[model samples]
Target: MTDRREWPLYEVFVRGKRGLNHVHVGSLHAADSTMALRNARDVYTRRNEGVSIWVVPAAAITASSPDEKDPLFGPSADKVYRHPTFYPIPDDVPHM
Candidate 1:
């Protein structure tokens, strides 16, 4: 008997060579975790633009919608100290 259930959807993240963070690249449907990883690699890193890959189930991510922007991120606006403008960045800092 063939399994008829739909494959789970996975979100793919790729970290470029000089990147400090993993950026969301795309999504794919896979039967299992291993397959998801492999598929993500083939689909997102085909040009070797990424040095690392991450795959997370689409259902696992929690995102705030544009309509909720004020309520979700409004608190940070009042915290001026967190802006990092008080510190002077050294000219030697690469990619800063």
Candidate 2:
């Protein structure tokens, strides 16, 4: 006999505000895409904690491993010149 107890895994992304990018919160399982989305909303956004939510299949998620992280993100560590430290901003600047 075969067991029919498996469900698709979903990854959740939530945005804090209307104009912000969605940040990954967590993952869960559901039967279908629509159900997965609804489950995510209920699971991650119980208190209106986020303005938006995104759910994608966990299988679709592709990422570099820790061993590759150093080589992948290491370039940014040495590129201090790319930072705003060299750029002189007026004290009057609001967010800068």
Candidate 3:
């Protein structure tokens, strides 16, 4: 016997009108990719809050473990020059 719980799980991302990037919203289980997208829209955007939606199979995502954050991000921490703090913006720049 097959359990419905075995249905593929999908991760949902929503881009709100005010947001510049898509943000993780929630997860849902569906039989296929098309259904997953429709289900994500119906479930996560009930209030019409999102301008865009993305649905990816949970199994397709490769994520770093939370416990390994320091190890994963440590190299970038010492590269202070990577940040634009030293750059002087012209007054003409609107969003800087």
Candidate 4:
């Protein structure tokens, strides 16, 4: 008899601060959420570069296909309101 346990895939993300975006570290396997966190610490935190960690199942990731990348995202390019270029930066503003 064989012990047939399937490991759930996880997507690991780490961030150094609230201002920084979480970056994908690598993938690992765990039996449960607790184990997933511990495994992430063991793998991604070894460098002491991250202040936070997040693990999400890879299967849960719904992403647009690369083949549709242009059609999916290109429309947003015309939405100038998303960019701050319309506003004249005040001299008082530190970072524009």
Best by TM-score: 2
lDDT of each: 0.92, 0.88, 0.93, 0.86
Model 4 misplaced stretches (Cα beyond 4 Å): 1-6, 17-21, 76-82, 86-88
**What TM-score do all the candidates reach, one by one?**
0.69, 0.79, 0.74, 0.72
lDDT of 1 by residue, 6-82 (tens): 99999999999999999999999998878999999899899988999999999999888999999889988899998
Task: Residues 20-93, candidate 2: write the lDDT tens digits.
Answer: 79898999999988999899888999987888788989999897899998889998998888877888889899
Q: Using lDDT as the measure, what is the rank order of every candidate, best first? A: 3, 1, 2, 4
lDDT of 1: 0.92
Q: For every candidate structure, what is the RMSD over all alpha carbons to the true structure, in angstroms?
A: 3.8, 2.2, 2.6, 2.8
Q: Write the per-residue lDDT of candidate 3 for residues 24-78, one digit (tens) a residue.
A: 9999999999999899989999998899999999999998999999989988999
Per-residue error for 32 in candidate 3, Å, reads 1.0
Residue 36's lDDT within candidate 2 is 91
lDDT of 3: 0.93
